[model samples]
Target: MGGVIGLDVGGANTKAVWRNGGERRAVSRPFEVWRDREALAAVLREVVAGVAPEPVEAVALTTTAELSDAFRTKREGVGFVLDAAEAALGGPPLFAFTTAGEVVPFAEVRARAPEVAAANWLASALAVAAVHPDALMIDVGSTTADVVPIAAGRVAATGRTDLDRLLAGELVYTGALRTNLAAIAPRVPVRDSSCPVASELFAISADVQLILGHLAPGAYTCATPDGRPATVEFARERVARLVCADAEQMAAEEIDAIAAFLHAEQVRQVEAAVRRVSGRFEVAPPVVPLGAGAFLAREAAEQLGRAVAELPW
Candidate 1:
């Protein structure tokens, strides 16, 4: 193929990587499909154009947006997304990369929608296998982390569907952003005694990461839980509110402590799942991190005593 545009269309964010000969460029855009299902076509066009101003030979896709509750069922969501891709990417032939590693035409994929839905992990794992051969690949996105096990230069994942992946330690439904802090840490340490978090969406992983300095103002892509600025000060305020305290009331050290604890908890969650998945192999492979939250994956991989393999591609 002359130029290939690869897309991982997610519910909250759509990521595209355009590879033309030896040059590769990528772009990410936020698009909540559940809010405006029809806007996907426009997003697809814009995302593609952002990566490649000129037309490409093919559009390859791995979609997780089909899991959005906007559709009654995953089957329906897959068909809708495929339709949008076909319509928006008018001339290029559309191909859907399935969890089984086959690239089927968009038209045929509608019939295999169930298998094609939410196959981003498998797609990534397959790509990793082509490069690293044997690796424990983990992609920590905004709302989820995928732990895929590859062995012998093949996709050795035990799970295919999202449900199966969740059960097989191949999926941890928590990430470096957008995840409710309460879900990761029900209780955080306070100055004097441990305190239970307020069971509200006052803060998210983004806040914890921002407050802890893992994320910058510009990289905090998701909307803050409190609709405030993405600054460290605002992040501190949101994280403090997790314990139902204002930033002024809580010492900066205390808030910092809580953010650190929550960040560790997030890493612990992924690390546990990575251990479970990597342990399945006779010899665990190096960890390859992808996505915006690669920092979190690196932290988790280090805790597991695994090398963080670099992807030259």
Candidate 2:
């Protein structure tokens, strides 16, 4: 059952996908690199070990974890990630996927760490573009959203780095889960009146999604903002706290309304990013939604009158 393994080491989570013939298995581990940067190697070993039916042929790695604040510089972070992978999977051949679509061997990654840094979107876009020549791919993950455009069988991205991508509308900081509620909907409607939200991490987008039924309890994989259980009722309580209220003080329906509004705001964020990125193309292409916030991407694509290409990745 050994074929290949693909791993994404993100700022908030580490995900691995093992593809061997017809069997595909995935493993996801919540790992806040900023909390304990050195522990990443252990996490890498754990996730791969959990998902591997047997030792895979080779390991392909992409990273946005390099953008985490744990390291003083991106170079350090990239080197650290490479080091972790080397330490964890010394037996497996390690390769790094770059923004330019180069499969760099681990020996070369350190010399070209800058290009290997935060190139997860390109890795995904290139994989999708292999099938769909011209399309707009929206990947709304837990902490960020990527709007990648592929044209004529080439990766047609306007920006290569995170900073440049943000400016080019290829990256939207708002995501489905981990994002703070205060960053998006600064104000909320309550009791037929508008209320200013507390500029705090009282709630996150995951709570809104849970209450809005966009995500189920099991799908809320990360830890809650308040460290409470991930349940619809608890999500409602978290959403209520955004407006300086609680479950007992606010009606459940009102909380639901708040969740709906927050959900719309997040959808609006991705939609706006998609619009901006699509403007770079001569003719806007259809959409391909990916990641945890795919529902939000689909909503945005529908609003833009673009047909979604349902591809099994």
lDDT of 2 by residue, 100-182 (tens): 88998999778999999889999889878988999998999997899999999898898998999999999999888899999
Q: Give the poorly placed runs of model 1, Cα more than 4 Å off.
A: none
Error (Å) of candidate 2 at residue 298 is 0.6
TM-score for each of the candidates? 0.97, 0.96
Error of 2 at 141 (Å): 0.5
lDDT of 1 by residue, 1-313 (tens): 3599999899999989998778999999989899999899999999999999888899899898888899999889888888888888989888998888889988777889987888888878887998999898899999899998888898888888888889999999888789998888778999778899998999889888888889887889988887889998888898888888997899989999999998999899999999888777788789999877899999998887888898986
Relative to the true structure, candidate 1 has a C-alpha RMSD (angstroms) of 1.3
Off by over 4 Å in 2: 21-23
Error of 1 at 89 (Å): 0.7
lDDT of each: 0.89, 0.90
Clashing pairs for model 2 are none
TM-score of 2: 0.96
